[model samples]
Target: MTIKSLGNPYDGDVDLRHGLACNCSDCADDAGHRMKAVSARDQRTRMSTDDMLDRAVESAIVRSMFGHNELSRRSFAKMLGGTTLAAALASVLPIDKVKAAILDEIGTPEKTDLSVGFVPITCATPIIMAEPLGFYQRYGLNVEVVKTAGWAVARDKSLNGEYDASHMLTPMPLAITLGAGSTATPFLMPAVENINGQAIVLHNDHRDKHEDVSTWRGLTFGVPFEYSMHNFLLRYYVAEAGLDPDRDIQIRVVPPPEMVANLRAGNIDGFLSPDPFNQRAVWEEIGFIHILTKDIWEGHPCCAFACSQAFAETYPNTYGNLLKAIIDATQYASDSANRSEIAEAIAPTNYLNQPVPVIEQVLTGRFADGLGNVRDEPNRIDFDPFPWHSMGVWILTQMKRWGYIEGDIDYAAVAEQVYLAADCGKVMADLGLEVPAETYKSHVIMGKTFDPAEPEAYVESFAIRRT
Candidate 1:
């Protein structure tokens, strides 16, 4: 809500907007009169939101100190009302000086040494490459890229402040912020690390079933997390074929590393996961690639660079530097010429912990599909740091479609608040990358158009929505 929403909080002829108490017929008349007198003094002198909030705080402190007790303080404030007390405080208190002191330490880094948590997947390539490629150090940062066990651990570490930032799925920050699968916290996704890097892999025996999704009704599949693009996209793919995801099939949350083992042990038939695990499974002769996520949504975001909103506000300089490093690394990774070198650099024991060739195949987009067929697709996986706000809206639509979130949602507000598109655009523009002017972009998924402007209608148009 806007500051104007505080209207009618108290009954009086007082003009709260200009912080004046008067028994006038029209508050706007009084405000205009005062503004004319003030404008004659200085046109540039104006009250800011910070100044107003600080004045409120000072007023509370003064009331608490002078009143007889807590009940007496409440009675005193209620007796005078908002406008009267505000005017009384403005006469007695030095509000502007207090506001200036409160805001004195802004726009500087509170901490320098920091840790960033990431899962060992190609989706986190931008975050991982930032350290070795000197992007982090170039921006006056000492960053430690910690490889976590899974998304859960990464989320926990970030929530507990063990890591200053984290590599997260595009939807994790939204889910965390909404308290969908965790406690509510204001999270921010400043940049998307990689897009279209995931694929669906099935056993070799069921290769024919991949063509006809309806034939795979009773099959069990795996995804990396409950609030993941893999799960949502997989469900969309299957449900489009007239199969219910909740009843017609079972989708279990399995870490990317254990997907192949789960398939080999007959625990799951296939998994929609990130590479180099998908490439690893194929190289080990366990599973064959069924479809790449790019085939579903060519430029879909898979992972993001996320941090709590509190951290960003507390360390503005450090957060900007971090965004700079990530955006620079993403631009470097987006080029096709740098794929091989990146594969070699990240496919070590400390990083992805997989064979270099497997990582190479994933990065280069040329691989054996485990069905005795070699494929060459250059855009199999790509890196673009722009966290389009439309993508956030779409993810929330899916969350509502599958019952992950409930009730009415302000889709645009949530998307705009959580996804740092404006900040990302600034970084991208500084790096000489093409930045789009519009915050929302329309896309087609499974042959259905999703208009970000009307997310609710898009969710309702679905035949399989839980809502």
Candidate 2:
């Protein structure tokens, strides 16, 4: 049998000549066949090693949990599903105690060498930097930080199992779980990578007109995705200025990478997009930063590290370790001292694929506003891994406000289930980070207070809302 060797321009030509007929005297007979066989055997050997390690970990858990009845416990676990077994154990054991035990005794990860998807934006600071910074490896995991094309692709890949986990918009998991734009599935956001990192950028021509947003009617704007903080904040900003976002102006869904080019080509007048695109526009002299999203709603959540609930349940230890890695990375990114180093780490082609200076400006928050003034706002972009349930409640209100989701929504229930605050809080506490006493916090978006208890009323409070 003749085997065709593969080659690419990036990797150079493949050597098809092997042994028997080989020109090199050091080669053995049919070396290529032996090499192929060895490669196949090595692949199986690696998989078996992981399986054996996982079984050993499970055996340890069974021994720890059941003492003398380890065999019976394993039998019961095999009969009932893992989820059911955990629930059954919780009935006998205090639920909180069981959770604490599980947290402490998390075993070998179910899966490693994971692929996590992200759009190359500053909001994904922790997830992107975890690769080069060795945070993932520190947690006994191997993670591939894949740079995706856009938010839609990222969401699709996540839903379809192409990515084990992903960097998603804060509202994406909620929307996905609720089946707003896609199939209904149980999605979970265990951590928020960064907050207040988005901005509304306007073409350089509109730099003079800052105060009166109402005067700029019929202008075109871009958002990365519909279920994104950028879209919600942009809508709130325009609606507050008495412009109906759906009717008054055109809001196009443009990927972050193309936002600056769209502005330069006159395809869009402006965009409410995640950095470093906003800073990229300024760096290229195409657009000016109009307002940071932080100014719209302080400490607002943006991009999240999300995975399916199925992924979490199937790989509990892997998920927990992944969360811990992200939490640690987030803590590191929160410090001002690490901002410059993080910017350099994530700016390469394999990650953000942007200029280092643009990434630095976005991270350090002292940037050229594109109006000839250097703004010094240190909190412009921040890393906080907590998945606050109140943030979920607000996003639901906005989704209902804009008519994306109809009918009565049990906001708090959905928020709690999808946000995974209890687990997130546990991880944060375990890491010695500050954990909020309550899962909910009231926020003021564009001068209007949003009470998590009264989401319906909050939607009604918006005069320019779709519903």
* Collision pairs in model 1: none
Clashing pairs in 2: none
**Regions of candidate 2 where Cα sits further than 4 Å from its true position:** 1-106
TM-score of each: 0.77, 0.79
Candidate 2 global CA lDDT score: 0.78
Tens-place lDDT per residue, model 2, 238-344, is 88888999999999999998999899999999999999999999999988888899989999999999999999999998999899888888998999887887876
TM-score of predicted model 2? 0.79
Q: What's model 1's lDDT at 382?
A: 94
Instruction: Report, for every candidate in turn, its global Cα lDDT versus the true structure.
Output: 0.78, 0.78
Q: How close is candidate 1 to the true structure, as a TM-score?
A: 0.77
The residue ranges of model 1 lying beyond 4 angstroms of the native Cα positions read 1-109
Candidate 1 local accuracy as lDDT? 0.78
Residue-level lDDT of model 1, residues 4-105, one tens digit each, is: 101222223322222232223344465654343332212454334443234333433443354212234445556998568667766887766654553352
